[model samples]
Target: MNKLYQSYLGSFTGLRKEIWLLSLITLINRAGTMVIPFLSLYLTKSLDFSLEQVGWILSFFGLGSVTGSWIGGWLTDKIGHYRTMAISLIGSSLFFVLLQVPDTFWTICLGIYLVMCVADMFRPAVFVAISAYSKPQNRTRSVTLIRLAINLGFSAGPAVGGLIIAHIGYGGLFWVDGITCLIAGLLLLKLLHPKKSVEEVEAPITSSQSAFSDRSYLLFIFTMILFGFIFVQYFSTMPLFYAEVHQLDEFHIGLLMGLNGLIIFLFEMPLIKYLENTKLSALMNVILGFLLCGISFLLLNLTGWIGILIVGMLFLTIGEMIAFPFSNTFALSRSDGKKKGSYMALYSIAFSISHIFGHNSGMHLIGNFGFAFTWYIMLGLAIIGILLLLILRKKLEKETIEISR
Candidate 1:
């Protein structure tokens, strides 16, 4: 037990104190993440929205996210990460509160889109902050630590949010989520004071390179978009499928969803530590992650048993753990300090636009063919993502070797 404790402690030894505090902030913020998880249920049951309506409304949210990420990256480069993050967090909180206003369908839909746009602007800023604060050697673990904090908060949120929705209602969920975001923004202000002048963290041939002109980064983004298309279905469609097919209640569904967070919180740090110390490359980890995620969905078709759902969630959780952190490190490794924010913002579009392709398509598929067909389609996409990621990895490796020479 003593040796085991030491090993775990050692894994996180060299990470900066600022990163730890950032992780704490993420944990607090995500703990209140009650809105999105239950949004589908609220729309269908409470608003009496058709599947098509729900799909379009959610796709609008993604549209807003796409705009937000672009603006956030540009802001991070111009104004600096600290200010960008602060504004995004505080602005998003206000929007969440406004979202609770009683309104018509078009009004509510517009509100949802605006809320996501303000909130998602924080994504690129956070990535820039993480890269600025971390050592290149420790970058992967640093990113993983942030994710671990998010999952820890997520583990608590859904389970508690489930209870809140069941007893207090969806309005309560929005209010609590807003309050938490405000508090997190305040904490960021207190803890992290940005340097007056952004320090150049890495030297590059040119700081003026546009991400639009970078062919390698573009290919990587394309690969990420494919992966994102498969992954976002967990948020967009999986909850609906569970409710419809499995007949699970809100609390039970929350418990199952929370299970994904719990698994990541418990295992991701140590797993990343072990892998980083091995010969396994980021690209290979990505390939395996995609394969596992695909298989998780495929498992759904194989069993109607609830027991299989846990196994499936386990695979999905592990896949997220491996793919997401490494993907961040890989992108950062390819970028220099000057272009980091731009690179991260572009990277974020993979997830932002995926909300459209993944959710809208999944909903359409389920509406017509049923849940089995949706999983089958996701499985096929994951396989394609794996191949694309593999090719990207090889090209990236070649580029790095040439740069070294």
Candidate 2:
């Protein structure tokens, strides 16, 4: 048992202090992430919006995410990741508070769009920061460390958020979210001093090619969009499922949602370290991850028992653990120094685009057909994503062989 504990601890060794600081910042920011998880619920219950209307508002959120990612990427390259991240954190915090001012439908939609525009700018900048802070050999582990912080914060956020909502109401969520963002920004400024921390480590530039010109990478992005589309349902529609179908309340729903993050926080880093040592290709791991996610949804369809929800969440969490870090490493591997920001931006944009359709479409499917049908659709989409990834793997291998010749 002692040896096992030590082995697990070994996985986190050798990561730079800056990476740890960055992870701390992410934890602070995400721990207050009470709003997004509960956005659909607030819209439906508090404001009494229809699911369809909620879907449209979420789509606007996605649109803003796409815009933010583009601008963030551009700024990261232009002004550097430090400035970009600082601007995003401080700017988005103000917007989060402003979002509560708009109560009506159109105003709410516009509010969400604007909030996400400034908020999501943090994504690409952070990725660049991670790359700058870690060496190539340990990069994936660094990413996992950051993810662990994210999931840990997520685990705490929802449980606390549910309590906040129960006692004070959804209004409290926005204030907390905004305050946390402000704190994270200030912490970043103080702890991660730009002159000392920025550009500490430099990844090698293998190619000068633009991310848009990379066909195989584009295919990989498409696969990520599909995976994200299915995976994001956990946050959006799955909560509604718990409420309407399983008859769970907000507190229990928060507990269940928090389960995904808690599981990831406990197991993901060691799992990723284990996978990194194996001969399995990153793409192959990603394909397996997709399959597990699909099966997770299929498990939901297989039974009406509440235990099945936990079982399904376990599957989804494990799939997330396996897929996300490796996919991030793969994207970084394809990038060169000059366009690293652009490549990571495109990657962030893929998930952002998925948010646009994933939430709305799932809500529409559930509203029209029902949850069972939505699960089946999610499974089918995951299958399609797996197949696309398989194709991408073959193409990547062919390109490698041709280059060797």
Candidate 3:
């Protein structure tokens, strides 16, 4: 029952028009984001790509995302989120339509790859906009609300994608994706106002300068890459494991994701609410969450037990809710208004880069070592992340002492 978080429900009795508009933008973007869960399926069914081929192609998508994050941050510094998002939506929508065009495999691959790059560019703008609009007091609540919008889309997207694939076929799904972007672009255009001056901004990771660079931030980014690597499994590897090994249908696959979104929606606010303001305790919560998810990953071979698979996703969501927000808050708190977009953009790039490495590696591990061993890889990664976090804590403390002057 924090007042700002209460607004996430649109249940604060009176919501600010600005917040309402921001929420609508969230809903619009998320409704379309549902397309990502179906990207591999599209490649397999419509483009006739092998699993490894799909992974390679999706790696391009990850590259596009990494590039886009930087571009978005720069745009926020130069233009504004409103213009950046508008362009991204329209550009992505056009590419979404282009990807649907019947073409040879490489043609489709390159086209979609570029499409992802252009489409991806809008996110930093959106994140910067959110941060700019928020007062420091309610920043976490705003981030949480944005995440809730994403999960709401996640919950609905796969179920809808399943139905679309079942009926209209894959092309229809892309068409819908295109349309969703168009709608989201228009909505954002209608609702968002451009920030004229830069004083309102808060994070600055976008610059190539050494000022934002620190040993602690480096450790944090490395740990995040590992966290993101484990997560990439959900999209590229997990569904295949379930299907080839456990023989699950699309419905069950969709259900697992839906359950994840459900858990985050109902539980994330409460969980964060319970945490105290002690930085160490919050960091520990995040560490525990990632470690738990890493361990639960091994249970994935139990795809035979759909219930167990679902439970694993449940654990993963718990870890994500605990870790990601704190991570965002930590990074943003360390940033200034002029470079906020850049910092977020860089953070987004780290996450994107890991997907490129993670899935390609996951495919290899699963093929050679099997499910159990593949998860062991995740376990090792998680442990490395935790160790780095501990190192970062010590480094930061020492830095603080030195800077106290």
Sorted by lDDT (best first), the order is: 2, 1, 3
Per-model CA lDDT versus the true structure = 0.86, 0.92, 0.73
Please provide, for model 3 over 206-297, each residue's C-alpha lDDT reduced to its tens digit, 9 standing for 90 to 100.
54543147556666777888899998888878877767777876667777777777788777765665553445554576687788778678
Off by over 4 Å in 3: 1-17, 195-212, 276-282, 301-304
Residue lDDT tens for model 2, 1-405: 999999999989999999999999999999998999999999999999999999999999998999999999999888989999999999989999888899999999899988988999999999988888888888899999999999999999999999999999999999999999999999999999776553534655656788999999999999999999999999999999999989999999999999999999988988999998899988899998999999999999898999999999999999999999989989987884657889999999999999999999999999999999999999999999999999898898899899999
Candidate that scores best on lDDT: 2
- Winner on TM-score between 1 and 2 is 2
lDDT score for residue 163 of model 2: 99
Candidate 3 Cα deviation (angstroms), residue 173: 1.3
Q: Return whichever of 1 and 3 wins on lDDT.
A: 1
TM-score of 1: 0.96
Candidate 2: where are CA atoms >4 Å away?
197-207
Alpha-carbon RMSD, candidate 3: 3.3
Q: Give the Å error, residue 251, model 1.
A: 0.3
Reference-based lDDT, residue 130, model 3 = 64
